[model samples]
Structures are given as C-alpha cells and as structure tokens.
Target chain A: MNDISTWDVVRNLLDGVLWTLGLSLTAFVLGGLTGLALLFARIASTAWLRKLAKAYIEVFQGTPLLMQLFIIFFGSSLIGLELSPWLAAALGLTLFTSAYLGEIWRGCVESVPKGQWEASASLALSHFEQMRYVILPQALKIAIAPTVGFSVQVVKGTAVTSIIGFVELTKTGSMLANATYQPFLVFGLVALGYFALCYPLSVFSRRLERSAHGTRAH
Target chain B: MTYAFDFASLLEYRDILLAGTLRTLALTAIGTFFGLALGVLGAASRAWQLAPWNRVFAVYVELIRNTPFLVQLFFIFFGLPSLGVSINEWQASILAMVINLGAYSTEIIRAGIEATPRGQIEAAESLAMTRRQIFLRVVLAPALRKVWPAICSQVVIVMLGSSVCSQIAAEELTFAANFIQSRNFRAFETYFVVTGMYFLLALAIRQLMLRAGDRLIGGRRT
Candidate 1:
C-alpha cells in the first residue's frame, strides 16, 4: 500500500548489484581453482584422470546453467543437504564456471609448443615441474585475455541465480518492477548496471586479444 | 539419505515432457534461422562500415551482448506491457532468443568478414563485378565457411539458454520439469531426467548444425 520513489528503486537495485558482484567474484575465484585442477587432470599422463575430467567438463557444459542451479537448489534438500539459496547459487555457478574455464585453459595449455614439453622432459624435469615452469608460464600469456573475458560471463551468469531466489540484480529488478509498476525503468536500470559492469571487460578483452596477436606476429 | 528416488512416477507425465521438448525445439529452430539472418545483415553493415546503420548495429550488438538474456526477456515480457505494447510469453521468448543470438552471431560473422583478404576484393573489382556480387560470391560464403563452427556453438548456446524461457511461463522443457516435480513431489528425479534430456538435446543440435554447415557451406568450397 506504500509508494516507492525512483531513488528508492535505484538504491535497492544498487544493493542487488553488490550481491551480483559478490557472487561473480566468489564463483570466479573458486571456479578458477577447480578449473586449474581439472586442467591438470585433463592433461595428466594417467588415462583415467583424463577421462574423468573430460566427463565432468562435458556434463556441465552440456546441461543448461538454469537446470544446474535448480538441481542443486531443489535436489539437495531432498538428499538432506539443506542448502540455502546462497549456498546453492554459489555452488552451482562455481561448477558451471569451472567446466568452461577448464576447457578454455586446456586449449591454451595445449597450444603451447610440443617442443617445450619435450625440452623440459629431456632436462630431467618431472611432469609437475614441467607444467609449473615451462608449459603454464607460456600458456598464461594467452590465457589472461580469455579468462578476463569469461569474467563477464560469470557476472551475467549471476542473473540466473535470481531464479533460485538469490536476490541478485535481476531478481531485485523484478521485485521492484512489481512494487513500482515500472518494469521498463526498473529493468532498464538493471541492464545498465550489468552493461556498466561488463562493457569494460569486453573492451579490455578485445584489447588484450589485439595485443596478444600483435606480439605473436612480431 | 532416506529419500526414495522414484523415477517411474514421472512416466505418467511423459506427455508434458514430450510437449515441452517439442516447444523448446521449435523455439530453437525459429530462433536460429532468424537470428543468423539478422546476424548476416548486421555483420554486413559493420564489416563494410555502412555509415549510420553501422553505428546503430554497433551499439545494438554491444548492448545485447553485455547484458544478460534473462533481463532482456524480462524487459520484453514484463517491461513492454507497461508501455502499452502487449505480447504473450511465447512471442517474448522467441523475440528474446532471436535478438540475443542475433547480437552474438553478428560479432562472430563480422570476425569472418573482416578476415577477407583485400586482394580478393580487388580481384573481384577487376573482373567488373558489382559490389553486391563481390560480397556474395567472393566474401560471404567463405566468411561463413570459416566461422560456421563458431556459429554452431553459439546457436547451441542460444538453445541451452532457451531453458530460461520458463521463467516467463513459456512452457519449455524446464517448465515441464517444474510442472512435473510440483505435481509429484519428485523434484530431484524430474530435474535429473530433464537435465539429461537437455544434454542430449545439446549434443543432437551441435551434430545437426555441424552436418548442416558442411552441406550448406563446407561442400561448396571443396
């Protein structure tokens, strides 16, 4: 029965933006760590590790993120995990991000010349030492741009968490739209919030790509 | 872990699941067709730098790409109605999918277009071919051929993204899963089955697109 002003709407949505950023950051960091492990498994000498890692990546990549979130959120309670929306959202996004980052980084790692691996092997370096010093250092250069670019996706992905009642930006926008009867303004600002967050990353990613290509050419 | 998993209970609601799968496929079919067409036009405008339209599409592509599709869908489904433009859930879902895929494919196709060798265009000009003919014969096919795999991936992404349409009550596969679980109190089983269905759908769509890309573009060049 009470009226909410435009300022109040903006403020509420801004609060939601913080949650979105927090979720994105959490997912990116956790996902990056998990993806690093997955990458090692994928390229490991043992066949079973490689096969298992491949399966994990394929399952996550193949299913829709929304369904992943739903399964984690709703399915967990049935098995007695009692996951809160926050925990489910974070866990779901972490898995999704890890799958993608693992694949992307695997491509980057594989792109490193075969000579480097052989040279390290000839130098009597172990597999871990070779990856730590030669292969990963070389792969890191190519990986930076894409990894940053993926952060934008991670940010946009937080919107889907709203479906599981995480109260992030998109969810806040919807609630405000209902309360204020101003879906256009509310959603537009919500979108603008994302654009503000993502456009810079996209531009930076492109710039890095250009620079990477430029260096490779020389 | 006292919960008994009963997948057989879902067998009774197979019709709902079947209908939902059909609807999702229909959405992806229409979305992919129109989205790629719009992408071609947008890519052309930007690749050639066609004055005002180029600038228009540049902004359009960035806006759509940077924002989440769910917000875009909410804007169309929920926001537009407030501005006196009414559309149903199905229309909003399709429109959002098309617009989302269009923006992405525009970027993908433009990368292909920009990679066209300058000498090829000059050679076409020397043959007295019109600009239109040069773009069509000399540029478009090869550009498309080069980027067809990326386009296929993006299309599958758009298809997977369609699962979110259930938020607006579009009655897609996810919606069916939700409906079934709510009815039978089998949330885990329903989602587990539906997620597997989505995985199979993604694989099928990717395979279909690859084969189509081969027939449509790849075969011509060789």
Candidate 2:
C-alpha cells in the first residue's frame, strides 16, 4: 500500500478542475443556444408557443438539478439507451441551464419598452425584423451582464454532475479525500479551485451589472 | 426495444419516500429560519459600517457564494470529525445549508436595507429615536417589505438546493429516490416520482413563503 502525498492530491485535483471547466463550457454553450430559441418561443406572438415555453421552464425550474441528473444518467438506461456520465451530465445541465437562461433572457427582452415594438411595427417591419433590428439589440445590452452572472451558476451547477460519477473537481476531491484521509486539505483545495474559477466571474458580473445600471441610468 | 415502466413498484416504498420528504421539509424549514436570522444580523452589522464586522461579513459572503455547496457540506461532514468536532449528518447538512443561504440572504437583505430612504432615517433621528429603534422601526420593516419577494425566491432556491444534502446520506428526498431505485431496480420511475415530489415541494414552499411574507412584512407603508 502506497501513501498519497499532498502534492499528488493537489495535482490530481487540479486535473479534475480541467474537467469541471470543460463541462461548464459545454453546458453553457449548448444551453445558451437552446435558451435563445426558448426565449423567442416564450415571447412569441402566438399564445401556444409562449405557453409551451413557460411550462417547460416551470418543470425544469421547479425540480432539483440532482434529480434531473439522476434521470439522465440512470433513467436513460432503462429506456435502452446507455449513456456515459459525460453525456448524461451534459444533457441534464443543458436542459437545466436552458430553462434558467431562457427565463433570464425573456425578462430582459420584455424589459424593452412596449413603445419600441409599436414603433418598429409602424415601420412595417416583420416580426423577425422587429426582433433582429430593434428588440434584441436593445435586450442584448441588458442581457449581457446577467448572462455572465449566470455563467457562475452554470459553473457551480456542474458540481452536481459529480454525483453521477463525473470526474469533475468535486468528485475528484471526494476520491482524494478518501484516499488521503485528509478531507480538510483535499476539500479545502477543491473549494479553492472552485473559488478560483467562480470568484473572478462573479466580480466581473458585478462590474457588468454596475455598468449596465450606469448606462441605463444615463 | 420494449421497456415497461413500473411506477407501481415505487408505491411499495412509499413510507421511505414519505419520511424522506418530511425530513427534507424539516431541513428546509430549519435552515430557512436560521438563514434568515443570520442574514438579518449580517445585513445589520454590515449596514452599521463598523469596519471589522463589515469586512468579516463581506469575506464570508464572498467565500460561500463562490464555492459549491457540496464541498461546503463535505468540509463540514468529513473535515470536522477529523478536527475533533464531531457532528451527525443531519446537523452538518442543516449547518451547511444555513451558512450557504445566510450568505446569499445577507447580500439580498443588505441591498434591501441600503435602499432605505435617507430622509426616513433622518426623520426618525429628528424624533430623538435611538439608532437601534430607528433601524428596527424605520428601516427594517420597509426594507423587508421591499425585498420579501427576493428573499422568498432565495428561500426557494435554498430549498431546491437542499436536495444535495442527500449526498451526505441525510435521508432526504433524493436519498429516498436512490434507495427506492436500488430496491426496485426502477431507477427512472423512482427518480421521476421524486422529481415530481420536489417540484410540488418547491411550488408549495414558494406559495407558503410568499403568504407568510404578506402576513409578516406586507401591508406596511412603502
């Protein structure tokens, strides 16, 4: 039996941080794309599309991410589709992130004044033209800060993927803690790794928020 | 491939599921209560502009806000025992949740508190009110009213977040889902039921918290 040194633990955990970053990036990109579509649906002219999008958001928002991960990981197998942890984690997170990001974006889009729509409509712009030329450009300004802010959440949310045996930072920390019998040092470093990833984004998000508010105030 | 879903098998484990749901509800209740209290104190202390307390609270909020809650739970559950401070899984889960939620609510409540109108506090000062009286009577209620919705949303987020506590084997709803799945080999069905329960729990908690807020903090003059 070989003893794991502190350096070995830290090195292994650092490797785990890479996976965490990868998963976060994957989820954020995929989720952002899906979220845009859902956002349009939520604010669509037709009543049914908006209602359907709202219901989708409600289900994802109302349930815990842990359960969603579980369903994706284990539930998929029951239906004859075997999924790796990576696939399950990515899928589950994408769904969860889409719900939230969609809602955040919808709020931002709606924050555009009703008069803007009226003005754009009077210009005889199509709905697509109205959104593309007038609405989304304005909404995008408000959305950027919160979107960056939500990236923090998407990062932290990756931690739950550890439950399904994804070898992300938290899971690696758990394994290292058990191996080294130094839960404090291992998990402390794990938290620090997360803080390293998340803190900067949080500060940047706040800065963006302040600047956004500053511009809005002006 | 023909796969039959057996939700009926899940009913056999209904008692465990019920117990887990109740435990989750209890954990959320206790954590929300203490978290709100801690938030109020942290907000007040931060608002006092007392140098060290403000710095200390800022650090606490930032650290907790940055890290994942699961690591925080592990640190408490696993790390504390190694340091000669022994605690059970339930205590650790609740403590971790309280600390996590407290940090969040501190920022939210502080925003509310800072938004207190300057003129109102000055009017209280003109009446020869003590600082504590002014904070309590003039500042806290309206600040609370202003931010009750945000606070309630945070509480719901914390409640949904509590699902992670099951990882430490605290016998929460998610734990029951795991248990029933292992028993019946109905992983999808078990989690599907559990997810539905959690959704209901979140909805119910949000409604109850909002009503409670209305009773406690609403109806006051803005």
- Candidate 1 chain B weakest lDDT stretch, 10 residues: B213-222
* Cα error, candidate 2, residue B175 (Å): 0.9
Model 2 chain B is weakest, by summed lDDT over 10 consecutive residues, at B213-222
lDDT (0-100) at residue B175 of candidate 2?
88
**What is the TM-score (0 to 1) of candidate 2?**
0.98
Task: Give every collision pair in model 1.
Answer: none
Docking class of 2: high
RMSD of 1: 1.3
lDDT, candidate 2, residue A40? 91
- In candidate 2, what are the lDDT values of residues B2-32, reduced to their tens digit? 8898899988898999999999999999999
- What TM-scores do the predictions have? 0.98, 0.98
Q: Give the Cα error of residue A80 in candidate 2, in Å.
A: 1.4
lDDT for each residue of candidate 2 in A91-132, tens digit (9 for 90 to 100): 999999999999999999999999999999999999999999
- What residue runs in model 1 are displaced by over 4 Å at the alpha carbon? B220-222
Give a tens-digit lDDT track for model 1, residues B93-178: 99999999999999999999999999999999999999889988799989999898889889988989999999999999999999
